[model samples]
Target: MKKPELLVTPKSVEHIEDLISSGADAFIIGEQQFGLRLAGEFSLKQVNEATKVIHAANKKVYVAVNALFHNDRLEALDEYLMELQRIGVDSIVFGDPAVLMAVRELNITIPLHWNPETTATNWFQANYWAERGAKRAVLARELSLDEIIEIKENSQPEIEVQIHGMTCMFQSKRKLLGNYFLFRKEAMEIENRKENKNMFLHDKERKNKYPIYEDLNGTHIFSPNDMCLIDELTELFEAGIDSLKFDGILQSDDYITTVTNLYRQAIDAYFDQGEEAYEALKDDLLEKIEVIQPPLRPLDTGFIFKETVY
Candidate 1:
């Protein structure tokens, strides 16, 4: 099989065209933010439209139904998903078993890449889904680089891990943040004071609020350290992993340059100079933020190291 390519998804039709224009291996169209902000409407029409344009340019597209949905919302998801299938989505990312089973029931036939939110670790579980027609599993974010390598070696399925992006620090359930914006609307205003780092509070519905910290000093509010494996390309390839995924739904031009360039250089070094070249590029692989007008957080490699270096 060919080596995996880098993917950057614009958050919506309004902001992603520039990103699509910039060169990337593919576009994971229809990110989580697309419909929620569209004034009481949500649909995969954006992905459908994006796929047509991207196909014309000869780039790949993956639609992400990548959110944690309540049981009440499954029916709506099913209907939208049918449209995705009819539109000829290259691949669709999903985590809910109900969603998975529903899609399969219709024999949609498109590849279903398991989203990490479902949190299925262990190779056997991955293969179990593969037999059921899942094309790949986007491994859990909590995994170490070694664990990721192990998953690739042991899992019978093709494994893809996030190579770069912001992450939620909590366990993968993502159910904890069920706190609604309607309940207390004040959390967004507190910014990041010491006493108010996490401003969200519990509401009458019994759902706890997700605090939005304004840590002026660094990345805050459920931000995971960015994963930049630019120079580590050979190690990931040698580990037998299939894809190196990048996170963030349409953000900035700098995001495009910093991420894609690093991987491009890393992949080239792998074939040209091998490990020695890779080692040299590893040092100072990150570019200084110059000015984090809002001041971003320092990075965390998460559990990627052999031991928990972070």
Candidate 2:
């Protein structure tokens, strides 16, 4: 089987080299205004600079132009796509049709990875975008293992899945958290709300505390446990997944690099020696990841082993 490309979101432009050293084959990054849930924002200049650096290392860079746009925001987007093309990025990850329209109107040639998050669940949806020009389908995190395999087996575009890091559960354009604080007349700074990594919403019924924060995209919430699919890598690779993404949102650079290296080692082991090598290393890798991950942010297989809602 061909080895899957290991993709990661860098914490910042400065962290790109470290992530590259940790064995990341490709990176997904963008400014906050255009990307809904990014680890950090990069100016267009930074995107140009970083793209050069990535290409120098013989790695790929994918810019996120995946935000839902307003009429006002649409004006700047066409130019942005053109600039990205000029910089020669490997691909653009997009959710909104406006981005695709802009690309076509500007005659931009950069490839697109369709990442509609929750909505990209089945083969028909995957092919619809592929037929329109998306080169890859970043499947929904909610898909069960069987569903993911089936989709890959039938879908025309290459498949990408999140193999590690936090999973976003909710997002909104309204500043819900800030409004709540305002309702209570609490004295909270806007920056505090934007950078509040300690904030969470507790679900008493599920007994889970979802990480929550507000940003330019408004309010966003994450799953209770970070998704760690190290154990399931074999299945994904064997099934012909083209890429595996590791989100670095809400994680320290050290943590992100460490976790990435662990996966790197595992991927190399599996491909170099087959399933038996991966099996022998799985237990030890999981133990290291358990110790390395933040105490509050637990790890699980996400929806891979769970039943999907119809």
lDDT of 1 by residue, 1-310 (tens): 2466667645555434555544466666553331211111124666677777777777777776755566766777777778888999788777667767778777777788877542666677788878877888878777777777777887776788777665554433322222332246644533323333334433447432333332212222454245555545666777767777766522354665455556656655665677678677755455432232113434445557736444
Q: Estimated TM-score per prediction?
A: 0.74, 0.97
lDDT of 2 by residue, 44-127 (tens): 999998999899999999999988788978888888888999999999999999898888999999899999898998999999
10 residues in a row with least lDDT, candidate 2: 187-196
Best candidate, TM-score-wise?
A: 2
What is the C-alpha local distance difference test score of candidate 2? 0.89
RMSD (Å) per prediction: 7.3, 1.2
Please list all clashing residue pairs in model 1, or write none if there are none.
Answer: 11-250, 145-304, 192-214, 218-296, 218-297, 219-296, 219-297, 292-295
Task: Quantify how close model 1 is to the true structure by its C-alpha RMSD in Å.
Answer: 7.3
The TM-score that candidate 1 achieves is 0.74
